[model samples]
Target chain A: MKFSRKTLGIPYGVFLTLFVVAPMIVLFYYAFTNGQGVFTLRNLTDFFTDPNTLGTLFYSLAIALTTTVVCLLIAYPVAYILATSKLKAKSVIIMIFVTPMWINFSLRITALKEILTLIEGNLAYYPFLNSVLGMTYDFLPFMILPIYNTIVKLDHSLTEAARDLGANERGAFLKVTVPLSLPGVVSGISMVFLPAMTNYVVLDMLYNSTYIMGSLIGSYFAAYNWHGGSMIALVLLGIICVFTLLTDSGEDDARTGGALL
Target chain B: MKKFRRILVPVLVLLFLYVPILMLALYSFTDSTQIGAIRSFTFKNYETLFTTDELRSMIVGTLLLALGSAVLATLLGTLGAVGAFYSKKRTSSIMSTVNQIPVINADVVTGFSLCILLVVVFGIPKDTYIPLVIGHVTLCAPFVYLSVIPKLKQMDPALYEAALDLGAKPRTALMKVVIPQILSGMVTGFMLAITLSLDDYFIATYTKPATFDTISTYVVNATKGSQTDIKTALWALSTLIFVLVIVLVLVMNLNSKKREQKEAKA
Candidate 1:
């Protein structure tokens, strides 16, 4: 009897069906159903109509946006410096920056909360600032690693050729290096943005704030409102799907010679 | 001046990254009940960490869970990668796309939905640790699949065929020829799975038994309450974990560097 290689995937396929696919189906079912389990679109309408939910959604978006921008701003320069620098032991330095991720993040956030309280006398006073700061601190390494990997693998000769073709240093960097590194930038943005939108732990530790989308879902589940919680989860899943599609298409466009100068 | 700027920027960022961790390490050794004040220099926190039964049990339980979940994820992930690598293009593409769902989805959603599916719908009791393990494996297996697929791509596609042509059984060919080539990728995937399990808070919070706690869940809950002794001891645990990770990563990096140098010489 011949053993087919295709049989090897059966266990994983079964696992995925039971865990990933079914849970998503269950989420959709609950989202469209009320407590009595009757099918209704009330959850959807309620999500959009409730001013508090709408406020939380938009506020979460704004916070996620701020965190991603701040992380990119800090991480790009750091990654660029580490990748392009001629210094020996640069990998060790990069390792130092990334190693904090291994420590349980709650502990680090707790430590950061202490430092903030010392400086401001009260973390509750600066909820937004502290939230962004904590998130930027947490997600900076995610942004740095991908960008560094991309930038380091970039062909140096391309930039040199641009310089040879009468392009100045700034022009070569802007036209060649930046455009070539967009894949990394986009990936970094996606990695940081979605998590920042949902990592209510940061807000919880730093500000005791629960206005974010993640904690909103938590509060719903805590109140035994599975229907409401599932709806929010479904909405978040939709946002993630759309965001992923947009970024993916953007990457495809960049790859097909759509470099912007 | 340009060189100075390059060095200065990374240095500043590194300071930003390390300061909080260093602060935590510093506070761990002191007798201070909080971060701002240093009442006395002592090793009391470290003592508390090892001596407390609850802390010890939680730490041990977390490590055991990480190991168990990582092992399961690696098996499923490697098998999926191998099967997909050998399958038809359409089937492989579908598998890959389905695999990406968990990777791209938020952890909060994944945890919540898993809780609903297994506990609420399927009627699995949460205390059995079944749902927790399944949740982690689901979170981790997609990543393992991703890492292993690249390794499969890098391997010589003809090697397996040659083994079979030489009269090796299909299982033999896979175990002897294919698995050896992807061992490094499997190891990487296993390590990643462990870290993901250890770092997870949301999934564990949603699915873990009411009496049990991983370090992540324990830290979140412990910090909320005013258990100053347990909270302070966590600082010690954090310091220890930080040191352990530093040593592990540095040694791995050095070994890889050595391997690269040997390859260059050869």
Candidate 2:
């Protein structure tokens, strides 16, 4: 629909301005300014001094990494299965994986904690494994979808060509399918990796924050430490921006490039 | 022989992927009744969920969160899609990419940042619905934008041109002509957003007011409480939701088949 420039520009301008752009500027500004409204580096310095806050950055990353590796290991086979098999009801399998994902994420995590508690006393019964499993269950979809998409797109002829050569079954898969599905691997792992590293909610829900980064921020907020919270977010945002820049995951292009469509 | 291996590998993978969810649903039924000797049969757990006031309220709250976020997300997403459509600059590409990040970003990180957005920067009181909605919408709107923008891009300029030529107002053209063509895409985005909003947890924990709760939270709380009735209800409820989702998906698939048949006939 054609319209006056104002009609077209004004509405979205307000939205982006108010919601996206404005808050971002305010957050960065809030990070620098103190309670008296003068500029200071205290918040940034304080972020570094607190072991709990600073330590969470790594804790968060470790969680994401652990989840990514596990998810990739599990998802790759499933992706390959979906890509290779002519099984009836492929959509059914897909639906089952996605169904829980559609239910309340918080609820699933909540349920997970319940299940863990029943399985053992509390996750304290098996702290490390519990956290990993918690992450694995929740973020499995992120790892699966992109890899599945990638596996589906892999050139099947390559596997055939590899077989025609002297390569054994394992070699053919390793040399052909794995390499060919690199984009999906790249995309899927990238999807899994970044979020896994940043995620602390699963850790919070399943474990008692015995060792987690996200929980620190949660507690800080709970304690009414706005200045410290903004500083933490600003730091995380900077790290994310850099990571996005380096990987150039092209996720934006893929989604809008008619991947899901 | 190679083909057989291919078939075997995929079947195993399918089993692996689909097993945990099925198991979770199964265990939910048995959690309470099968007390000793591996008691695997009973609906007592499900009974507790339905009977408990807290569980009932949580279910309602989760449904409300999903519904509210999905509606707001779909509306904002449509606007973002429209904005993306009109965007001739490289900025749309960047925005779309940035928009896509939250969908894949660690929920914990987004929840953390959103906490900052609401409780810290805006001085929004902690443990309120506003933060909950904002957290959900931030995550959900991008999916809607991703879903709707492509359809909007594919619209025929001629249809719009004709409407304008016939003296239809800009708003009318968008409402009557543009929306019809893009309705399916919009619907897809809305469904996605609904699911996403429903799926949220990380944000709920952070932003949810101290006393506030949801289906997910209740399950977690109950597990921590006694590992009994409330937990089973959550399982039944999650199963119910899954069943409903499966049915809805089947219906949509059938509807799409019918549409394709009609199109082919036409």
Candidate 3:
């Protein structure tokens, strides 16, 4: 039907105002108002000075980068397989991988914790490794689905063109399909990297609050260190906000990173 | 010979993904008080898990929370998506980003922020389902929105045109035309929302206490502090989860095959 824009505009505005703008305003209020609205930068300043907090910051970046690289290595091969193989039950393979997506994240983390604890009851060695692996497993479906979607959308005719012009299989596949799917890679990387960097609970549960970003903030909250927690929150949010903004700018064609959200 | 590479690719990929998960599934069966006791298999853990009321309730509670959060989030998110579908570019961007923030923002940050906001700012009671549901809905909304938008975008405007041309009212056109086109998006979104709510122990911890011990929380506690029986109980739970996941995968695959066949017919 021929509806006017006003019909949709008001409802949409109310949704955004309540959910998006209002919460952020509350966030900023809590960030600045240390029990009495003096509007100070104390939280931001304290975040930089604290060594333990800073250490966790470094750990988060290191873990996120490592997680992204490992996920790429693992997911690339899988995407390549789903792209190339003419298997009749390719949908079955997709279902198998996506099945993990359906399993509760907490359960998966708990399961990983079980296996790791079984392997080494002690903490100090590889909880970080386990955490990284857990994040990878949890987010792998996110990584694979987008890249696979890109591959499916790719023009196989390019490979035919490359092969006709005398390039070998490796050269054709790489030179053709891989480069063209960079948009998917961009989408996939941001998709995996953002949450992986931010998520610390998997580490917390598995490593018993080993002080990654997720756990660090969690610990502060548990301790009622609202100022300290918000301090860390500001820093983490600052690091991620640029990413949030980049993605917010409507990179619609770049990647559908919301494969499973 | 080159086709060998194509054949081998899938096998290798499957091994990479499944090997660790399989190892996890296996360890769920073997005894774990000897923590890494790989050889000894027993049904003792299963007996204990099945017998425990706390464990059973945690399972049920977690499922209920997951189902509630997913369903509610999808409902709201679907509303937001439909609303956004008719909004201007700028407004839609803001809404989608807002929808997205919960998913991308760190669980800790969101959890911490939400707890403070709910208790300190909004003056809500501490550790209630209200807070937990709000926190989860914030996270789950984007997932639903994300899943729905692509299908919504891909949907042909022609159907809406036809419905309207047939003199259907706006609501009727949406119900008859737009809704059917994006139903898969809604389904996928629902599935994703449920999955996320299930995985979320972090926010739940901040908002809800041990009174809300989920499977993840239960498993976490079970692993610590020289607790052999608890650990055995955890192993049983893990095996159950693994088997359940395998069955789910099979069902999903079958569903997808049917969809593909129906699409082929269409």
Candidate 4:
């Protein structure tokens, strides 16, 4: 007996539609409806109007943005050095940075929490700071990996060409290397920022507070406030979609710029 | 100055990464009752962890979920990848885009939304391993799908055609010629799925039954109100996991290197 490739894809299509697409539909249904299942926009309105909820959204965005910036500042230099260095054990060193990831991140964060406590004595007094540090620590590798991948795959002659064109080392790096690596930086920012926005474990572990969008959703779910939780999640889904679209447009710009070059 | 910085920066970053983990590992061996104070070195944390009921169940439950999800995801995903590879171009493109939803969506949203589906929409009871496994499979299968599709693209089209021309059945041609070509991708996908599933906390937390607990959720629960003993036991578990991973990675690297050398000689 023979089976067509389209037939082979049927099982997967069914699985995806049932599990992924259907569940999302359910999420939206819950987001818009009240306890009686009547359609309503109150959930959405309540989310935007509630000061605490709005504050949590702001906090989530602020912290995620800061974490992205910190990760970029730290990771760019590290990834640059790793990519350009003549070190013999470069792969081994890169592996070192990656291996900690295999260890459960929550465990790493817990270890970090312990160290922070020992250093400062009162992490509670600095919840935002601790959460930022934890977010940066937890996500720095994510930022590094994408940027490293791009930098390593970069055309060496691009830099050489810039230098050949009478550009100094600093100018060559700033003009050529930075532009070429923008895609990776953009991707790294998206990866880090999206997760950091929803990462309640780091916040909960560091601050024991539900101050971010993720923590807020988690608390609502924990309390069986399904309507509230789903609404927040839907809003987050919209935000993430817009965020990805913006970053993806930047990537398109980079691609066009590279093509022009 | 440049030479000094190249070494110094990496060393500093590495220290930042490893110091806490090493310290935690060190603390795991010590009798640390208070949060920051280690009094004496001992193996009691491990001993207690090994004997405890809740911790034992948590470990078993975690492994069960990880393994079950990894295996199921790999099977479904490999099939999906194969299907995608041979399907029409337009259909394949659409499938691939839809598949990335879970990968890009926030973990919190995925977990919460799925929880809604299982509990409210489907009316499945909350807090069972079934939902957790299903949730994890959903999370992991996409990774396998993405990984395997690339290998399939890279495979030689002639191999399968040749097998078919040699009078092999379609299934035989697929199993014999195509599967072997994509075995590495499948293996990579399986490993990736396991790692992703094992490290997950958010999806597991929302999807899991109240009685069930993965290592992540257990640690989170223990850390609530700062249960020192449970936290230390987790550190011991972390040390064990860290050592196992290091050993496994090293062995894999060595084996691959040996294989490469053999290939070069041939």
> What DockQ does each candidate score versus the true complex, computed on alpha carbons?
0.53, 0.34, 0.43, 0.49
lDDT of each residue in B21-130, candidate 1, tens digit only: 88889989998876778578899999999999999999999999999999999999999999888889998888888888888899999999999999999989999999
Off by over 4 Å in 4: A208-210, A249-261, B34-38
Model 3 / residue A94 / CA error / Å: 3.8
| Candidate 3 lDDT for residue B238 | 63
- Tell how far residue A154 is off in model 4, in angstroms: 1.5
lDDT of 3: 0.71
Predicted complex 3: CAPRI docking category: acceptable
* Cα-based lDDT for every prediction: 0.87, 0.68, 0.71, 0.84
- lDDT, candidate 4, equals 0.84
Could you give me the TM-score of model 2 versus the true structure?
Answer: 0.84
TM-score for chain A of every candidate model?
A: 0.93, 0.86, 0.86, 0.92
Best by DockQ: 1
Expressed as tens digits, the lDDT of each residue in A1-261 for candidate 4 is: 367655777777777887788888999999899999999999999999999999989989999989989889988999899989888767666777767777888888888998999998888888888888998888887777777778888999999999999999999999999999988898788878988899989988886575788988888987998888889999999999999788874442222122111
Interface RMSD values for the candidates, listed in order? 4.5, 3.8, 3.6, 4.6
Q: Give one digit per residue, the lDDT tens place, for model 1 in A22-46.
A: 9999999999999898999999999
The better-scoring model by lDDT among 2 and 4 is 4
Instruction: TM-score for candidate 1, please give it.
Output: 0.96
Tens-digit lDDT track of model 3 for B66-128: 899888877777777877877788878877766666666777677777777776677777556
Instruction: Judge the docking of candidate 4 as incorrect, acceptable, medium or high.
Output: acceptable
Name every residue pair that clashes in candidate 3: A105-B199, A106-B199
**Candidate 3 lDDT over residue span A68-93, tens digit each:** 89888777777877876678766556
